[model samples]
Target: MSRIGKKPVELPSGVTATVSGQTIEVKGPKGARSFTATDDVTIAVEENAVKVTPRGTSKRARQQWGMSRSMVENLVIGVTEGFKKELEITGVGYRANMQGNTLKLALGYSHDVDFEVPAGVTVTAPKQTEIVVEGTDQQLVGQVAANIREWRKPEPYKGKGIRYKGEYIFRKEGKKK
Candidate 1:
């Protein structure tokens, strides 16, 4: 038995879960998210918790059981508490600003890069070098952060570019004379 799959997922207040065929939909005050379970995995919603079970005893079934459980649990939590990702710009002229529903980034490039914020996702720049992305869906929030981060990945030589807050970048020293 899978340890994680065996544990029941507790349902928070104001959250409702419905299983339709192979898809499980979770709705809460924040928003709603759905995920489909694999063929070998099954999800059961009880009074106040969710249980996952594997149809057969096999390596693939075992793996899908745990993964499906975790995905469902994430959907529940995401709809309830939401998710956020923070990014920081590092460079002499690198900065980020939010205007309306767009994020403008200056990453030492000749032209500024503008990214349109998708509906249901909020982007805020507390500081010129810091950006915060908030959304009720975990997958959307993470994808938005990654798209912004791709604008300027950190360079090893100078450790300059966009990076997640508290992320460590290995710096390479300049060659000796």
Candidate 2:
């Protein structure tokens, strides 16, 4: 048995969970999130806890049982606590700014790249090279951050470009004479 699967998911106050067929929906103070479980996985929501079970003893079912449960549990936690992703610009002229609902990024490009902010997500630039993305959905927050970072990935030579906060960029040595 999976230790994570055996652990019961504790529901916080003001959060509601419902299991309908293969779909599990969790609503919290921040927002509501839902996910569909595989046929082999089953979920049961009680008064203040949620339980996950495998429908059969097959290996496939056992594998999916814990995975599905953990996913559901994360959805619940995500809706309640929300998620955040931070990015930092590492170049001299590289910077990020927000105007209204649009994000303006200057990453040494001739023209600035403007990204539209999606609903339920907030983008903030605490400093010229710092970006903070906040949202209730973990997937959306991470994807957006990744997309932004892709615009200008850090280069090894000068360690310049956009990168996640606390990310390490291995510096490369100069060419030999």
Candidate 3:
């Protein structure tokens, strides 16, 4: 038995969940989110809680059991509180600013890099060195943060690059003369 799948996801107050065939849709304060599960698992909502079970004893069925349960839980949380990711820039003259719906970044490149913010997600720059990404979908928020960081990854020598707010970069010493 899957430990996570065995536990039903409880519906918070003011949140409603509906299960139709293999699809489950959750509606809450934030918004409505739906997830379609594979035939390897069966999804049901009972007593204001969502439950997922494997259809067979095969490995694929078991795998989908846990994953489906987690996805359902994420839907509940997404429509309620949502997800957020933060990024920080380091280095002299490196900064970020917003232009309308686009985010302009200065990372020691030949020219400023303009990143167009995608729909359904909000990007903000409270300070020149800080970038905040928020959205109802967890994957989208995380992917946006990673794409921004990909522009200038933190180096082991100088650690001069964009990284997550709490990320730690291991410093490397220069060659001995």
TM-score of each: 0.94, 0.94, 0.97
Best by TM-score: 3
Cα-based lDDT for every prediction: 0.92, 0.90, 0.94
Which segments of candidate 2 are over 4 A away from where they belong? none
Candidate 3 clash figure, as a count: 0
Q: What's model 1's TM-score?
A: 0.94
Q: Comparing candidate 1 with candidate 3, which one achieves the higher lDDT?
A: 3
What's the CA RMSD of model 1 in angstroms?
A: 1.3
| Candidate 2 residue-wise lDDT, 78-176, digit = tens | 888889999999888898889999999999989999999888789999998899999988888999999889999999999999889999999999899
Pick the winner on TM-score between candidates 1 and 3: 3
lDDT of 3 by residue, 1-177 (tens): 789889999999989999899999899999899999999999988998998989999999988999999999999999989999999999999999999999999999999999999988999999999999999999999999999999999999989999999999999999998
**Backbone collisions counted per model:** 0, 0, 0
